[model samples]
Target: MDLDKVSFNGQIVDMTEDEDTMAVEAHVRALVLLEDALKKKEWLLLDREIEYEKSQELDPNCPFLHQQLVLNLFHKLQEVQLLKNGDSAGKTYVYPNPDSVNIFLGQSFWESKEYLEQWSRPGTLILAASQILGYRNVAGTLTASDIYAAFETWMNHNGIYKNGIYTCCGEALRDSVCKESSMSHSLLPYMNEFDETDLKKATLDILWDCQKKCLLVEHIEKPQALLAIPEFPIITTSLVQELIEKLKQVKFKCDTRADKIAYTDPRTRNIIYVGNHFWKQKDYLSCGSRLGTIILYVAQLLEHPHLFDGATKDITSETTVEHQGSNSPRSFQEPLNESIHNHDRDPPLPLKNSTPSNIGDALFNKSKSETYGKCKHTADTICAAFEKWMSHKGSYENESYTCCMETARHSVCNKSVMRSCLSELESRLKDFV
Candidate 1:
């Protein structure tokens, strides 16, 4: 066969008939076509069609016919700048780190044989770049501009250009870095602590902050209360307000209906008696009265030691008994012996099955009949409110539940014991219902 000849920069060179020489020539020809296609921004031309074209001119059986071989050959060409020597008058481009370039191009090739096949579609490049940069640590010393420039060059060479592509690329890169940094350092500690819902919320919040503020990953603040154990049946100002409103409703019911109920019945009379004493306290609506005193009364009524342990805060004279450290919920069944009245014959009977309306009527009659009393409407509201509060499902049904829990965890109860106690109190109330 006549010795084959190939042209480089218009210089015709004789090629030997050796198979190795043909392979080298094929490799060189492939590189030439690749560089031309890149310079002209012909992405489609770099696909398998071009490979078949090279195979026609050179030996189809050559080892360098595969795409991987083409990539390896490209890497060698870039390393030696052999192609740049072929163009004395062409502009010299400053290449980024060869490894980054390989990654960028290698990803483009392995992921899709066509250079811009997938990337040419909107947002695909940015999405791929974000995932790669965020999840994988392949962006060594590559700035947003560096990646953008590489992408721009690639696209420009393929005769494709868009106005906001650079900005989008930069944003994607920035977000990826921020996400990786935040997740790895700031949020990592609390990640395991959060349940699925909380984790999702926290992650979305962090991502929002990163994208919206363009914050540095290190600058992203850890979510507040992420590590803190949340208080069950969280108490809130709204919750307290709701409780107070409910109390007012109970008082209204009592004031309007006291005359209708027969006071001779033990259950009916006890409801009125306990309700009467509850409404008599001066601090009936006070935090100590509502949260502490009422909680204590319920514990006393239920005879639950766990409730008493959790609810025993000094709210009124009736709740004078101090909490003795008891492990069992059954240990403290006896009601506190203190009296809300000086002339009391017997402590009012526990209204375990009494309705809120009955308790309200009792409160109204007690307030009307009593001349002097220390703990008045406080106890009444406690009983009435407990009935109403527990009648619904768990505390989660209350609109104020979340806010109260957050408040308890973040502000009101700093100690875990206090939170546990409050939780215990709420649990007992639910069980009582």
Candidate 2:
């Protein structure tokens, strides 16, 4: 039986006598070695390049002195997930390390800079990269704690911490080398405590400086409160402004010779613009383009949910033309009962339990005096027409609701005469409906 194998590797060899006892004894020895390694902070026990030779003479009892024993427990080391990768090998845990944080920030900024600058939005990428480095806020927005956490995790992952305690000056380092004592492995004690707001501000300042260096990072808030992530699918007041700026840049302009006033995108036909001179043409497009759509969604997500509501033509041009043709109905009027006599004969008695002038009759009387011709009327006129149509069936009999058929101002009625008068009325009614 190889006692060396059982003792060093902490594995019990199958034996005829006292097998359980042997296993217990081996396990106890393995615990002692692990505790010793823990005290020295040599947690990278599974690293292939462990310094066995240097520690063998210096510390005869060091667990690493027996390389075979460490290798034998490779399965156990893997089970614990402490097997160090190339970059993490020989690293130490040092939370809140500034230099490590700076390195990560530098790398992330350069990687995401192009995409951010192309869309001119910066907040999102910075926030996502920070999260990847272990600084995360639950609300999907950047916060101070997230920044600090990211830095700390990056420093630890990169093995930037010292292994022993040190004074404010050089004395502690000298003692660590001479005595071979454990070092201060944590930077949390030395780190200056900062509130969430201050930490957030510091993070912003760092990003702001990156922006000034012509890096694509940007903060949209006026005072630079947060980084601008332009690709994020959310709506904000600032995002709306960015979209408007892009639209304005592509706004169509014509020379003096052009007679028809129209707005169109000169570069691309993706957007649709419609409106008159009194109203600025509202730009319309599917919110699918990465650069444009995200900003629109952002505007809706933020404070301007109504930003895209009125930008497009609700009714098609075909419908507008159909309503304006010669075949179009002259005016909207409620059907009168054929049984009721015309003005040439006396009227019949009111229906059972019905008044001489019911609500329907009163409403019809109000609508009879109004006209909806080629000219557009206010909402009030449309409302009056609807109220009468909704009420009295017989009230429009005597009232002439005819519109001007000629395409010019009527000589006697003094109303604009146009074949499109019926279409205008329909359009106004549809709008109200």
Candidate 3:
């Protein structure tokens, strides 16, 4: 099996193989299917037992194929592992990974002339990347409550006053809805005690309705003209500008404006009064209020349950296998592969055949042996390779230098920028070799 041919053998399994060759054939088929699945970004539904039936038919002595897939296969096969999930509750989620970041960066380059345009729309991957990278001042995992608070903050800062009481189009609609929410036209129905499940269901229903109504008010009417409204004064502050810049940097372009007193709901022309005082309170909550939606959007996009938490664990090959006769049948969790886990922060591990022999090997191959090489000249070569990859990806400026590094560090060795960098070095070494 030539590693080079592994690149293009999409349909390598032959159906005519005899029983003696069936086990090997089955293994090949599984690998091929798995690779194909990854290319399509379909992570789930790969563990179907039907795929293994052919091998069992051919060789009764064949070992039972593992149902679980490990992240190690990513390193061995040289593919980025973008997401991970299991059959366990709260465990099955797609979290951000380095490979996914690269794909997004690459996409930004492909989709827009200005990479920053990745932030032009709501819920872009760039927003998620910023949160994951801790570029924004946001300090914790995002949550639904955070999103609700953000909406409220936006409202409080922008609300118009009617008889000294702050109100906006959203509030008007919300008040009406809340009043009607009671089945008997009173709050009595909602005020009643209920079991945990029933209360949770009721709460979710109300929240969902509130969100729709908020959207409705926003759509109902254009905000009254700022010039015509005597109650609102034009705000002037550098902090507001700074806030906008921060939000833009993190890709959370909230609808906060200083020049405008109120904004019109694009759909219904309902005037929504949102003041510009949210920036007055200088705290993390202010930042969270501004960017909280983006953070939650990121979490939802990745299907991560812990909006404000870090990843559960690194998925590696050593810990991919499950023990037989275990009490846990619905899901499997292998022991952590200490070697791989510990070495994650280190440079890529050396392959048995690719150890560098000297400075020449280090220079030409850019193998792991050269990772410890303490010379500026070797460092120059690696930097040059990195620049080339960035150029190929249309990143001509150093603005994305940290982003690239973060993506590389998060990826498995084979699927990482280290591999790309090494491959770049090997190509350069071809003439020298």
Candidate 4:
């Protein structure tokens, strides 16, 4: 539990080095398995045919296969999300962004990188499926109408079978799915009338696909080359130059040029995204996309019918109990102990203890302190710990800075100018204790 020893456990494997060739082999195997499934149109089947018995064991929990699935899905969904909005209807996914500026930039990025490269390999893209939809290669000339008609028929099929699901209130669900769905082939055959939750989940996946695809097109175009594209001709060189500098300041090297196009979510949708760096949104956290994408991802993932039913809720509650019951950090963190013990008896709450004292204590309760001394003590401790956390985050970021090499300007800007910034920051934190 040592905080200072947070470096990755064990020796770091140099991926490019011959010694760590296993990692390379693993990735290749995964991509191969994924391609076999997609080329055969076995997406949902792959979901059902999983390693784990439980459904929750998807996404990150299914680490070995998740990224490849997501990537492949994104590649399949490209035709829908990347094209201009039109009679395309359900044939394409629209960027969730309502803001015109965001849409334009997103479209520019999609056209930048040849998104086709993502799926041109022996297997699916390494890390992008499931979230994207609408990959129909019907006669190499599938129109929007064909896709929508197929989707509508699928909806009716599911509605006929699931008709009993409607109570007086929930019964109205059939009409809902039909309303939101534009037009497309129903990927899920038994889904004639999706409830509100179902539609939301589908929407989330579509939006996630949009963001991933947006990066593909832009990053494909070299920054200089993009300026010459018919649409982005007058893009100020200064802005592009500054953007490049910012990326270097953080040591972010885009393996693919399309990854350079920035994604900005102005929080129009209260969704947030969660995934590995490879599957995550570009510059995910601090980037304009922020919590919205993560929320979107989780919320959508949670939209299945079982998720809303009592069965899933009870399971989640049980899991929470097993993972974070009473024997937790509250046993050691005094303030947290009192807070938990005194909390109103409503839903059972678990405690998290697998954290260092600096962060773990911050979760304690200060609201119930009866005296000024107790209140001040708890307040001070929380404030001090927060300051320490901030310093650590700042130092890590400072150490991350890199310098950009300008071929014309022969000068170093911020190349690993490691001062004692981290050490100095740590020293300041120690005094707080």
The order of the candidates by TM-score, greatest first, is 4, 1, 2, 3
**Using Cα atoms with residue i matched to residue i, what is each candidate's TM-score against the true structure?**
0.15, 0.14, 0.14, 0.15
lDDT of 1: 0.25
Error of 1 at 218 (Å): 27
Residue-level lDDT of model 1, residues 188-228, one tens digit each, is 11112233233223323322322232211111022122123
Candidate 2 lDDT, 177-231, residue by residue in tens: 1111111111001112242233223323322322232222122222111121111
Model 3: per-residue Cα lDDT at residue 120: 19
Error of 2 at 115 (Å): 6.7
Q: Is candidate 1 or candidate 2 better by lDDT?
A: 1
Q: What is the C-alpha local distance difference test score of each model?
A: 0.25, 0.23, 0.23, 0.23
Give residue 102's error in model 3 in angstroms. Answer: 5.2
Off by over 4 Å in 2: 1-101, 105-115, 118-135, 140-433
- Per-residue lDDT tens digits for candidate 3, residues 69-182, read 312232322332122111122111111232222211112212222111112111122222222222212223222122112111211113343653434322332111111111
Question: Comparing 1 and 3 by TM-score, which wins?
Answer: 1
- Which one is best on lDDT? 1
